[model samples]
Target: MSRGPKKRTLEVEEIISLYKKGESTTRIAELANVSSRYINKLLLKHNVERRPRGHWKRKYHFNEDYFKTWSGTMAYILGLFTADGFISQQGQTVSIAQKEKDILEEIKRELKTTQPLYRNKSTGVYMLYMHSKKMKDDLMNLHGLNPCKSNNVEFPYVPQEYLHHFVRGYFDGDGSINFKGYTIVFVGGSYLFMDTLQRILNDKLNIDTNLVTDKTNYRLFLSGRKTIQVFAQWIYKDKNLFLERKYLEFMKEKTPLDLLEDRKFRNTKNAVKLRKQKFLEQLTKTNCIEKASSLIGITTNTSKQWLENDSDLKEKVNILLNNNK
Candidate 1:
């Protein structure tokens, strides 16, 4: 017989503990004087499966989700572009000329095919086209769609001309507005004009501009046929307005208005009040009323009014405040 049955070579428990603590199989193998394959086998024997790593979660994930709730369709379109590799989240800048060219090419390719454009079953409206087989495959893979389903079959032709017409009309229509340098193209109908515009500016432009659309009422001032003209002029005068105050003087001369009398400008004042109220509420909830008030640059009286007007909010504030005290 062998010497004590070869010491029984036991390490299953040690291997499992290391695996649970996220140690790599190779490292565990090295430490345990076993092959990586054996370490993997030990992991399998213990019924442990390694999880694939994912991209880092962003701080703005919550804010982005909230914004999406307010602008679901617009968010969907943006997500489509992102899925199609037209946009990047890494803060790398692409030239406007290059983006326009790439988008045009994508439009051309998309028009060549017959794809089932998604229709909003609830509203009886056609959503956008899926365009390519690759896109369809991606959707199938990511969303796990059944390929046999026939509800949203791909169309055979793209109707490129119709698409072009729609694009031109959509931008030229009543919902369009111009921002500092670029034209703010709004999609959807009249009821969604302001909301759509705000979402576009906030989500797309804010990445580069450092300007938050929700904080300003620029959309209100942007309307009618003159909106395009103002937008184009702004673009012509300062292509880099978002990065610098390059065209402020020029824009002021071209579109001078009484800030006090302008309804749009006045809306900004209301926004400020709302923002302060929210800041105070958050501060009180966190029990850092004095610190948050100072950090928010708001007066105590304003914070007090917000607390008094909303009794429910006041109760939350008191809890936070007392807990800290």
Candidate 2:
């Protein structure tokens, strides 16, 4: 008589290693060249406390079919979800957390759901959650995100047109901009995710970024006045989709300032150059350096110095003045 299939053998270390790395049962099965049922059996044998099926409460519900359409709001939420949302293994609940209550409120409004927002008093974190498999599946199917996603979460397949909005949402969730030096940084625990974001930045916006890894996570940063300015405008194309405080911080970065003796401004070199050209255009209409200086709120001496130092400006101003006369 032919013997039944040979007894399947599994190495304890191999199973434990994959599970510790946050691999799902399905993923572990693929890697181990075994069935998902076998992987579950090993977990049971090891007494691993697997994730529960559903959330504790079931007071509210939502029609997450709204997530099917591709809109800026949806794209933004997708980014936010990828950054902070988690789907339960039961596929019945999707949860997101942040420190901003208004963002939670905004998410409720966007999904048109009646789910109540929760706050952790000890941690000061605000949460918005729902019991909807549709939402979870939408995220997984449309965006390639899965349940129990944390450190190993990969970047989603955002549409080419909505990439900016998607990244903006991600930034609003996990990014920080420094007012002191105007540095833009995005922090996450996934090296793969950061690497994909860096590639998108270069491909979509032509922005070059540096990828630095700390002990726990990765940090993607853009430095210098020019790169920061470009990235700021690129991410915040839709102001309504972002956190108010973060948007205000960006506004502070975008605000124009008076010219300094060193020809400095709170902007990149290109922006400063553009402003100076505009100032000269206004001066051209006046036909006099003193009047132009007055129009720009700069002293006549400054204008004279600029004219002496910048031959291009001098030539353009002279031509305009002659034509006006």
Best by lDDT: 2
lDDT by residue (158-239, candidate 2, tens digit) is 7877888889889988888764455677989888899999988888667567666656778776654555667777877765
lDDT of 1 by residue, 1-325 (tens): 6644222133577567545544455545544556768777767767886646432222111111221221222222222232222111122111111112333233323234232232223334332222133444433443332233222222111132232222222232222333332333333222233444344434532321111122222122222223334343433331211212323423444444322121222348678667666675667554555334433434345567878887876777777667777
lDDT values, one for every candidate:
0.36, 0.71
Please identify model 1 stretches exceeding 4 Å from their true place. Answer: 1-80, 83-116, 123-125, 129-275, 278-325
Deviating ranges (above 4 Å) for candidate 2: 1-58, 254-325
Residue 244, candidate 1: alpha-carbon lDDT: 22
Local distance difference test, candidate 2: 0.71
Reference-based lDDT, residue 107, model 2:
83
